[model samples]
Target chain A: MKAQSDNLVEAALETLKASTLRVTEPRRALLRLLAEAEKPLSCEEIRARSEGEFDLVTVYRNMEVFREQNIVQTILLESGKQLFELTVEGDHHHHIICRSCHRTLRLELCFGGELERYASSRGFKQLEHKIEVFGLCETCSED
Target chain B: MKAQSDNLVEAALETLKASTLRVTEPRRALLRLLAEAEKPLSCEEIRARSEGEFDLVTVYRNMEVFREQNIVQTILLESGKQLFELTVEGDHHHHIICRSCHRTLRLELCFGGELERYASSRGFKQLEHKIEVFGLCETCSED
Candidate 1:
């Protein structure tokens, strides 16, 4: 697990360098946290888990940069909240979040290709897509 | 077009009332703006188009109420901005927005059923999904 996370951080660092982004310490710390996250994290969670290595504004700033470079993806939740995670290597997945408790689980499935084709037929090009699902998880559903 | 928009506003007012929400003048005006929108409007757009009938904080407060009552749907854009619209009856659709020009067009397609089923099989229930597609529109594709 540690080796996999290390590779993810390394790959992300290369992405930063190729994009001419400075490899600052806070940025690296942020990357490590994302690569190790089971689910995407809110900015507040990032600040808390980061142990004061950076402030909330710095987290937001670095996240904005990461997002622009496609090194990070934001999952906009059902409650109008947003969370961030790294675009990990070879593990493309979406999430199903419990609206009741905010418990999240990854779904190793995607259907973006079909959507892209549909958009392409309408004269859209170079398409990208984001999808999020929300529901009552098993325990919450029984409530 | 005006008649359809009026109908939307009326339906939204019903939703607000059903949810025990107040039918304030500012809320009414905001509903009118959303009903007449060709596409979702950002909070800034809401403020600009509202013509000072209320303030941004007021706009946000009303939107939060409407959102809770399912009177409004927020389309989370690829740029990580959010736009608001009335959840128009019998006109269910998603958007494919232009990254370069910010042009948005509605697509008469959705596959939420498949996603919901996938989540359901995983013991989730009462599923809700949101999808947003981003690409260069025809005009911007050549740029």
Candidate 2:
């Protein structure tokens, strides 16, 4: 896991270099945090894990830069807080959120094949699609 | 369309009454705006459409309130801006975001199905996922 995380960090650094963003400790720390995090984390969670080395504003600002450069994806949690994750470049996917526990499940499927045709039919010009589903997990339902 | 929008407003009002939220003009207007908007709208867009009736802070606050009550769905736009849309009760869906035109297409497949199983195997317990995808549309690709 540690070696894989190192590779993730290296990829993040390359992304930063390619985007012409300055390589800063906070940015590097964020990359490490996301790479190691078991789930999507908010700015507050990232700051807490950083041990106060960075403030919330820094996280927000750097995240904005990362998003603009397509290095990170900001997902809107049902909690209404923005969660950050490293974008899995070249592979598109969707998510299922546990309605009971707020646990997120990421799935890989380009399900917009039908919607693309639907949009063209309406002349609305379909551009993109994001999909998230909320439901009970097996344990939650069992309980 | 106007009649449909009005019904949405009425339904939203009923939802507010069911929740702990206080129904105010700004709140009402925000719900209406979300109901009628073809795509999720940012705070700035909502404020602009509201015609200066509500401040950005008020819009932010109302957004929090509506989201908490489940009266509206908040969309995480690719631009990192939060957008608002009225949730279609009992219907599960996701979106396709166009990278070129910033247009959003809604899709009906529960793509995150396998992720939950994956999480269960990993013992992540109560795993949930939020997924947003961005790419060029057929129109944008042709352009």
Candidate 3:
């Protein structure tokens, strides 16, 4: 696990360099956190998990930079919350979030190609799709 | 068009009563706006179109009430903004928004049923899906 994590950090650092972004400590740490996260995390969730290492505004600023560099992607939930995750190349995916617990799960399924084609047919160009599924997790449903 | 709009207001009033919410002028005007709209609107957009009739804080408060009653649904965009639209029964749909013009068009196509089944197979219950397609409109693309 440690070795895998190290590789993730290494790759993230390379990503920053490739995007011509300065590799600051906070940026490195935020990248590692997103890279290692099981699911996309909101700004608040990221701050809480950072253990006081980073302030909220700093995190938000770094996230905006990361977004511009395509190092991270933002996922918007129906609840008007934004979640961020590392943008791994060749691994396009979506998310399924538990409405009760707000736990997000990565989804491998993608139908963007077809959806994009449909949008293009309708005279829309540069199509990007956001697909989010909300549900009750097993524990929440049981409760 | 006038008759259709009148029916929309009537339906909206009925919706408010059905939810046991008090019908007021501001609420009625807001509902009329949503009913006549071509797409989901953000609070800022709503205020701008209100022609200085509704205060920003009053709009926010009324929106909260509308959401609680399920009269209006919120759509979160990748830009970290929230959009609101009326919730019409049995007419489930999504949207394709132009990032440049911020114009939204109703998408009649839906694949939520298939997605819900997939989530159920993965142990998720009470699944709801949100799909938003973003891009440039024809005019915006030409520009």
Candidate 4:
């Protein structure tokens, strides 16, 4: 697991360099966390998982920069919380989140092509869409 | 325009009464604003439109109560802002927002039934989904 995590960190570092973002400790830690995470994480979740390494305000600022650089994408949930995940090249997907536990499961679906075409026909350019499904996951339902 | 707005306020009052929420001055005004809005309004927009009749904190608190009572629904934007809209009976829609100007357009298309069925098959109960599209609108693109 540690080796795999290290490999993920290396990939994150390469991404940062490609985007011309500085290699700060907090940025490195956040990128690694997002890269290795099984699901998208909110700012609070990211800070909590950092084990007191980074502050909430710093996480918010870094996330803003990462978003501007396309290093990460934000997933907007129905409950109005924003979650972040690494934006690996050619790895597009949607998310299904458990409302009770906040557990997110990635769905490898890309039905946005039709939606994009529709938006384009309506004179919208550079169209992007986000779809988030909410429900009770297995563990939460069982509980 | 005055007559139309008055009608909308009546509808909002009815909704509030149906949801068992008190028809307070701020609540009534907020609901009326949402009812007459062409697109979702953020808290800042709401406050600005209120013209000092409602304070920022009062708007926030009223929004929370409205949300709990299902009198209003929140639309999450990619910019991490939550916009409020009236939750009228049988009125369902999504949104497409302009990235530059933050203008929002209502989309009557709802393609969530199939996705909801799929999620149910996967053992997810009480499934709900939110879809938001982002792009440059005509004015923004022209600019």
Candidate 5:
């Protein structure tokens, strides 16, 4: 587990360098937190893990900057709080949030491939797509 | 346009009735606002359309109630504001948001069909998915 976490932090550091973002301590820690998250995290949760080593304002600032640079992606939870996660290695995917357990799962589907073609046909160029599905998970399904 | 809007409101009211939620003036207005919205709206926007007839507290309270009854669904936009939209008539879909113009197009696909099968084969169950793609619209791309 420790090795996996260490690798995640290291990879995140590399992402920052590759994106022209400065390697500040707060930024580094923020990236590490995002990379390690099993699901998306709100800004408050991100700050809590830092043990007051960084200010809340700093976390917000760096997160906005990193998102602008495309180094991080925002995941929305059912609770209406925006959570941050590292952009996936390649290609893009969407999320499935469990209505019962509130658990989140990543679903990779080019399902929107058809939608893109449709848009292009309509002369709506430069199209982008985002999809979210909500329902009972297996555990909640039984209950 | 007004006739179409009224029909939408009527359809939404039927949904509320099926859920056994009592229809009141505020609830009716809220549903109408969501039905008319081309995209999800912030709480403030919902209140604005209510023309000061309903207070913010009422909007928040009714939204919570509506969400619990599955009469509405919420999304956290990239802008970090929580937006509410009417769930489609008896189906789930995603959104394609134009970052430049903030226009949102509804998207429908097979609801995690094959992917859910794959995940189930791997011992994963209770999946939920949300997908959002961000990019410039045709006009923004041309600009």
Candidate 6:
């Protein structure tokens, strides 16, 4: 899994609290669902996996909040759809997403830190980078 | 410049026609503008730089069409804003966007081709990856 589930729930809640965000039940439930998920999930998928207490809009809003708090990392598909995964503390990696099935595979590889440094030299502060891979997976490729 | 201006206007128009899309005047105008721009531009910026022949909606629709045809690249910023650039024929590169100024810089560095190969070995077909760097640029960092 890209993100480790162990202690993810506790760590995620702690992160929200540290960010001064409210620890509402819905937020807690969202965090728990993401922590247990083996892969990133869309807002629709998140809502389906969630209790009926939260609606689609709530899922979207909460996900956005979580993203800003660094509690979740979002993978943007070529079609502009996004999938959210819980962030394991201090773990930074990319993902390979199947275009057909939308299944995700965690990739341990990341662009080197030199990239951030390169931007730093260009006078950029608070530098960051994002990468996502996309393609047809085995089963879909055979079809 | 990532996209070469030499013959770009003619080439872009021909591309549209070859793709069976209409070679409208607005499209021609946009092609000329982007071919001349040293950097990417947002839709609003594109319209502002336009000849007043096309509205913002026209620029938006045309840019989306260009993206689908691989004639343009869209960089999604952390704030969800997108910057669009004309693609030079056979030219592929990423960008480093400044968070404060919303400006962009072309980066010659790309993740190695081994990434696609790695995904291919993992049973992925037609593999592709996207990378973009983000940070505060010098002017913004000092602000």
Worst 10 residues of 4 chain A by lDDT: A107-116
Give per-residue lDDT, candidate 4, residue A70: 77
Candidate 6: which docking quality band? medium
| Candidate 1: segments with Cα more than 4 A from true spot | A22-24, A55-58, A79-81, A141-143, B17-19, B22-24, B140-143
- By DockQ rank, best first, the candidates go 3, 6, 4, 1, 5, 2
Looking at chain B only, the TM-scores across the models are 0.92, 0.82, 0.84, 0.84, 0.73, 0.87
Sliding window of 10 residues with minimal summed lDDT for model 3 chain B:
B1-10
Candidate 4: stretches off by over 4 Å: A1-12, A23-28, A52-58, A138-143, B1-11
Q: After superposition, how far is residue A72 of candidate 1 from its true place, in Å?
A: 2.6
Compared with the true structure, what per-residue lDDT tens digits does model 6 show for residues B1-143?
53457588778788888988998889888888888887888899899998567799999999999988888888777756677888876688888888788788877778758678778778898877888788888888775
Residue B17 lDDT (model 1): 81
lDDT of 3 by residue, B2-120 (tens): 77767767877787788778889888888888888877888888988888797988788988888777778888776778889988778788888898988888777788877887788
Model 3 lDDT at residue A112: 87
lDDT for residue A61 in candidate 2, whole number 0-100: 94
Model-by-model lDDT, in order? 0.85, 0.72, 0.83, 0.81, 0.71, 0.82
Q: Which model scores highest in lDDT?
A: 1
True contacts kept of 2: 0.28
Residue-level lDDT of model 4, residues A80-134, one tens digit each, is 6788888866778888888998887776555688777767777889789988788
| Per-residue accuracy of model 2 over A1-143 as CA lDDT, tens digit each | 89987787888788788866789888888888888888777888889998999788999998888877777776665655677777766656665556677676675445567656555553545345555555666667676
What TM-score does prediction 1 earn?
0.84
Q: Local error of candidate 2 at A80, Å?
A: 2.9
Best DockQ among the predictions, by candidate number: 3
Give each candidate's interface RMSD in Å.
2.0, 5.9, 1.4, 1.5, 3.9, 1.7
Model 3 RMSD in Å is: 2.6
Q: TM-score for each prediction?
A: 0.84, 0.59, 0.86, 0.81, 0.73, 0.86
